[model samples]
Target: MGKPYRECPHCGAHLDAGERCDCGEPEQQEQTAAEERPRMRLIAVCREVDKDTGRIAVICL
Candidate 1:
């Protein structure tokens, strides 16, 4: 299951893939001003590596 989505906490509008809410709400002023957001990192995984050579199925997201 995925996390339940909710309306925008700032202006009660809605949030997409954007940082700011739909409206020009500044409710997150304290949060943004007080702390800094970190960039998301993608990690890959190797399913199986070749025994003879050096090959693997690197899965990425």
Candidate 2:
């Protein structure tokens, strides 16, 4: 009935036979790279101070 199509492994886009998908393109690579890295946020900071020596320690979560 209809022409056969295949799914792109990288982006899951349906492509016609012999067609190329843009998932491996430079812009897509940059986007994927950004997505793969872990993102962190500074929730809180805690400080401990010694009474006699006046030494301080910092803890972050």
Candidate 3:
């Protein structure tokens, strides 16, 4: 039988006995949080007035 095999945690590479893994390499860790900014757009605004001369608006998208 071949040497025991195990799956690498970082790159998912199959590792065998006496093999080295680059899971701790800097390049691989850099892209983990690559500024995945979200995109949003303003939808609409609603306004209402009361007898006390107050204004309230509810925004909805």
Query: Candidate 1 residues 1-61, lDDT tens each?
Result: 9534557765676555544563665559767865676765979877899888888868886
Residue 31 deviation, candidate 1, in Å?
A: 12
**Candidate 3, clashing residue pairs?**
none
How many Å off is the CA of 17 in candidate 2? 0.6
lDDT of 2 by residue, 1-61 (tens): 9758999999999999999998787897788999999997886565888889987766857
What lDDT tens digits, residue by residue, belong to model 3 across residues 1-61?
8547887887889888768787767774556555454556787776565658676666687
Between candidates 1 and 3, the TM-score winner: 3
Residue 12 local lDDT, model 3? 88
> What lDDT does each candidate get?
0.68, 0.84, 0.71
Off by over 4 Å in 3: 1-3, 28-61
TM-score of 2: 0.38
TM-score for each predicted model, relative to the true structure: 0.30, 0.38, 0.30
- State the displacement of the C-alpha of residue 47, model 3, in Å, after optimal TM-score superposition: 77
User: Which candidate tops TM-score?
Assistant: 2
